[model samples]
Structure formats: C-alpha cells, structure tokens
Target: MGKFDDLPETRRKGLEKMEEVYGFDMSDGEGDFFRYTADHLFADIWNRPGLSNRDRRLFLIGMLVGQRANDVLGIQVPAALKNGELDEDALRELVILACHYDGWPNGSRMNAVVEDAIGKAKRAAGS
Candidate 1:
C-alpha cells in the first residue's frame, strides 16, 4: 500500500476533515511523525466506526483537561464549537465535570482556554 492506500478514500476524506476542522498540515513539516499523523492518526483512528466526531471532541476535551494540554485545547475547543460539535453551555458543563475528576486547578486552567477558544470561534463566526 502507498502512503494512505490502506484506507484509500477514507484516508483522503479524513485528511480533508482534519484540514477543515483543525487546519492541520501534515506536509508542512519534515518528519515521519506528520505522515503517521495523517495516515494513521487522522485517517485510521479518526475514521474508526464507533464514535462520532462530537464524541471524539468530548473525549478529547476531557483528556486535555485532565492532562492540562492547553495548547491542543486552544485548537480543538474552538473547532468543536465552530463545527457545531459543542455549544457554550455544554462546553461549560463538560469542563465542570472534568473539574470534579481532575481537580479545581485543571478545570480553572482549561476554562481559560475554553473562554479563549470560544472568543476566537465567535470572532471567526463574526458574531
């Protein structure tokens, strides 16, 4: 199989979605990791059958909150809202739930990122 031949059209669609949703650019860098990100992470894993993209975003948000991955959340949180996978209230509730599990600090920091993401999403939406 070629670079994305394992999943073929699915891989292409996944790449397009990644670009559309996250503005990811695998070809911009010089690393096998980017290729793997495109061919496997986005193509294979993201296209997997069970969860919808909305579910994936929710899981990602929780994981990011738990891990305090503010940088990734800066991208994903807005994408979630922009793509209609999440709304403001639901995002707040999810962060609150994560706070219960991860502790107050994580929730607090993630909430900042959430606010920033929501602001950017709104600006992009021109509202």
Candidate 2:
C-alpha cells in the first residue's frame, strides 16, 4: 500500500483540509519537507483524535501569532474563512486577542498579513 493508503481516515481528512487551506500539493515534487508536512504534520499530528477541527484552528491561530508566522497565517486566515472556522468578525477578534499576547509589532504584522490574505480571497471570489 502507498503512504496515502496507510493513512487513517482522520489523517486523510486532515490532509484534505490542509490542501484546501494551503493549496498544498504533494505531486509537485517539492521535496522531503513537503512530504513530511503532508505525511507527518497534517496526518500524524493534526489527525490526533481529541480535538475538533475548529479547536485545532484556534490553536493554530494562537501558535502562529506567538511564533509571528505571518506568512503561514496568510494562508490560514483565508482558510479559516473558507472552512467556516472563522468569520470576519472572529478574525478581527483574533487579531485583538493576539495583540494582548504578542504585542503591537507582531500584531501589526499579523494584521497586515490578514489584510493581504483577505484581499487575495476577495479577488479570488470575484469581488
């Protein structure tokens, strides 16, 4: 069986969700990093039973903010909207909450990334 074939149902779903969010493609021959991300990070970690997808998304947002991972958030914020994990208002609240923990500079950086992501999503949506 292939690696994909060996995936648990939840892991397969997690991989699908990851692709929807990040446009993550395994067929691009990107490298080991992408493979590991798809197989291990999304499959193994994200698929872990206990947390719902919504709970995972919330945790992701917090970790991204704490890490100042604005580039990752560029994809995540839009995904949150598309996946119905977060609406615009919830996104705004996330920024506000992030500011309290991450401070102004990082928060502003996150805001900029969110704005850029929102613009990208809007254009994709024909607005």
The candidate maximizing TM-score is: 1
Query: All candidates' TM-scores?
Result: 0.80, 0.75
Global lDDT of each candidate? 0.77, 0.73
Give per-residue lDDT, candidate 2, residue 2. 40
Q: For each predicted model, how many residue pairs clash, with residues at least 3 apart or on different chains?
A: 0, 0
Residues 5-40 of candidate 2: C-alpha lDDT, one tens digit per residue? 566664465566567555555432247786677667
lDDT of 1 at 114: 81
Local distance difference test, candidate 2: 0.73
lDDT of 2 at 11: 49
Q: Please give the range of 10 consecutive residues that has the lowest summed lDDT in model 2.
A: 21-30
lDDT of 1 at 100: 90
Tens-digit lDDT string for candidate 1 (16-43): 6577567545333336886677667877
| Error in Å for residue 99 of model 1 | 1.8
Model 2 TM-score (2 dp): 0.75
Model 2 residue runs over 4 Å out of place are 1-17, 20-31
